[model samples]
Target: MGNWSMFTWCFCFAVTLIILIVELGGLQARFPLSWRNFPITYACYAALFCLSASIIYPTTYVQFLSHGRSRDHAIAATTFSCIACLAYATEVAWTRARPGEITGYMATVPGLLKVLETFVACVIFAFISNPYLYQHQPALEWCVAVYSICFILAAVAILLNLGDCTNMLPIPFPSFLSGLALLSVLFYATALVIWPLYQFNEKYGGQPRRSMDVSCSNRHTYYVCAWDRRLAVAILTAINLLAYVADLVYSARLVFVRV
Candidate 1:
């Protein structure tokens, strides 16, 4: 979790510096990528990253530490992370395409949904750390593969749009995005159902609830019990599935309406 916090903070600092330099130096025209897409995309991910670190750090480490300078610093960091999260969220909202405004794809509804789908996948990846959770069964392992495959597709979509390389695609980008979103929805739906069943249903040698196993209950555990993390993954999978469904709807509309 400490490592997670460090990465988040460093990313925020670097992005802040870069944005300041680009804007102050009038370098937007020289940027290789679309200025509009880059900032909106960066803000989306930065908000999510800071939000994740803010939640994970306090839940994973701050509560376990004794009252000291370290704990105080941890608390301070979490607070700042939350503030950064809000700031970035505001940036996204303020710059997003309004009802009548023309803007980059990153500011549109489907694009925002893509950001959310990726972020939820990131959270699911964070929770599914225990190898024993999925390695024991081929079916459970398939669920892991589903998560990875869908995450990769969504990430690639985001990158393609970010780099303004969607024009290089064979089909219209909206059609491509709609197809990808539909595929992700199916993949996540399968994982959402399979993961919880394999992890919680007693019929599969799984716990029916949170386990009392020493490793799970011990403070040394990074986040939560294995069972709880399993539950978290299940929940995040569902959330991502929904986000993809919404993305599919919006992208399909774009293809049909040519908007």
Candidate 2:
């Protein structure tokens, strides 16, 4: 199951990366930002995200829920992914419709909102999965504490960035990128914390019973861990990171060209 989960995650990540590269690098590069191109781009993104989630949700339901684990984390992750897709679509539509409404620092508010939504989603997932860790005592305590702190920081950073944009606070590209980097780190960190719980289950619960049993009774366990759940998270993290990097590069170029 563990090996299968790892494989699933890798496959999903690879496919998503390819799609993103083609969309942002090839398609966006060739097409002007018009209503026609924007819808096409968004439609592709929506399709990919939904397809990936559909692959993930059933595994999550079968593996986690059937094992006395709550489906909250899986549900939260799915919800977040769905909302993230919608937010991206909205951003593309809004930007195409009102290209000149906001420029410079203020221009990033919509993207920042998307980031905020993602953060909220991550926190919800973390909280939902925390109980599994709590069964481990002191280690769980430390993990939960650290996760809470990071979530608070992420929330604060999002609010600060949004406020800066709203107030026209003269934020530079470096500052924006730094905020994004921090958020990315927090996201991956949260994933790291949550992953151990799944590992624990794979190790102790299910068929293993702490006997190093590699055999899985739940066929969906393999799909859940391997392809469906973790892969979605990995792809989402990659997409956020790529978009952040692109925004940073573009903003830096604008600044440099102006000077």
Candidate 3:
């Protein structure tokens, strides 16, 4: 499991990055900017690009440069293939329902359903891409870098919300979007801070190791049995479930109001 985690991590991120790029390219014609729902749907591309290009690409580069081994690539590739299919489904739905009047608060629904897939990928990759976030870096440097990136991305997201862009305009949705963006950044940055401190703790080896296989209540997993890992896992899992729930609720609302 030395580089299996790192390899799988790189593979998943690469596949996701590829899928996102290809999907966006293909949708350029299908979901043109001239369409009324373009901005609404475009937010999905923004979020995925931020994660895959801005975040995942750098990590994959580091992983390959340092280890250059993709032992368990197939597993991670298969997982992302499923996510790619989900992404395609979202695109199909958008292609079928585009260029129409978005009744009530519905403009955000289709784009948001697609955006939810990216959020879910982030969580699912938490287990697959464990340790990559802080891989191949000194403790202080890792913390500082992640802190800076998360901070800057959060600020940018808030600024985007403040502008006349996306569904975060002219209503209560802006506040919700801002909170979501900041909270996401905070959670990601918090994990970075916690992992270093926890690794340096005198309890779990007292050294900053790459990865660990731990057991929690008979469930064996790759994350260390540390407070930071537990907290991050819980937060990511909660966010994933919440995003799915939001998608379902939005779909229901759109259908009910339309009916």
Best by lDDT: 1
| Estimated TM-score for each candidate | 0.93, 0.37, 0.31
Best by TM-score: 1
After TM-score superposition, the amount by which residue 12's alpha carbon in candidate 1 deviates from its true location, in angstroms, is 0.6
lDDT of candidate 2 at residue 198, scale 0 to 100: 48
lDDT of 2 at 240: 45
Residue runs of model 3 more than 4 Å from their true location after superposition: 1-43, 51-107, 129-230
lDDT of candidate 1 over 21-138, digit per residue (tens): 9999999999888887888888988999998898889988888899999999989988999999999999999988998688889899888888888788777877776788899989
Runs of candidate 2 exceeding 4 Å displacement: 1-91, 96-120, 123-127, 133-151, 161-259
The TM-score of candidate 2 is 0.37
Which of 2 and 3 is ahead in lDDT?
2
For candidate 3, write residues 88-195 as lDDT tens digits: 446545644444653323245533543554544444344424554345446534443443454344334333432435554464454544454445445555544565
Q: Quote the positional error of residue 94 for candidate 3 in Å.
A: 16
Clashes (N, CA, C under 3 Å) per candidate: 0, 5, 0
Q: How far is each candidate from the true structure, as Cα RMSD in Å?
A: 1.8, 13.2, 14.6
